[model samples]
Target: MNHALAQAVRLAPVVEKVHGAHHPELTRVRELTQALADTTDDARIDGYYAELRAVTDNYTVPEDACEGFTSHYRALQESEQFWQNR
Candidate 1:
């Protein structure tokens, strides 16, 4: 796995703790990241990447977001960059 995806995987539990496991954004992040990681097909990768991009909203950090959330956001952004560059 790539560094960004690895970082996200590491941070996921912490982010869930801070944001709550059921948080929509976190759930989407987990779902999309996992899907991206699990897929090898080019079309599926692109599709998942697009969904992840839309969900992350350029990884804009919310004003009231906690450190965990911000960190996850950065990781997700890096993951996005990794996919885009690939």
Candidate 2:
């Protein structure tokens, strides 16, 4: 998750540069990414997951998910493992 957050921080500006600052999805990603990057506390991380759940309904991947969707969920699951060990 920390790595993902760092990547988000690194990529958001590039995304905005190409997609424009007003692009809503990228903007939201930036906000969430920044929030995650700003902390290492377990409680705070849990809170971020709460917020993410509110946004993504527990990261529900549909049955008909595309490759990207599957990869995203897989990454999140790995992130959870990483966080647990940290």
Candidate 3:
């Protein structure tokens, strides 16, 4: 529900479109993000964070990442901080 999480929620579709349906990671990320957005319980958000971290591997960004990729990675990191600090 924080700004960074909200931003990542908004950015998911663009990432999915760029990665296409063939990219399983994006699909999983989109699903987990949507789940996070749908819930109000903090416990649920924490659970989602665990799954998201597994998917993102702590939001690690590749050196060769394009702008979109890097933005998406940074967004995840920011969102994670928002969630954890809550």
In order, candidate lDDTs are: 0.76, 0.56, 0.78
Q: Which stretches of candidate 2 lie over 4 Å from their true place?
A: 1-30
10 residues in a row with least lDDT, candidate 3: 60-69
Per-residue lDDT tens digits of candidate 1, residues 14-81?
77667764456767777777777787788897787777677767677767678878887788788767
Which of the predicted structures, 1 or 2, would earn the higher TM-score when compared with the native?
A: 1
Clashing pairs in 1: none
Which segments of candidate 1 are over 4 A away from where they belong? 21-23
| Clash numbers, per candidate | 0, 0, 0
TM of each candidate vs. truth: 0.78, 0.50, 0.83
All models, RMSD in angstroms: 2.1, 4.9, 1.9
Candidate number achieving the greatest lDDT relative to the actual structure: 3
- The residue-by-residue lDDT of candidate 2 on 1-86, one tens digit each, is 46744554666556545444343444554466567677877798777656655654565655654555445545444555566677
TM-score of 1: 0.78
Candidate 3: deviation at residue 81, Å? Answer: 0.7
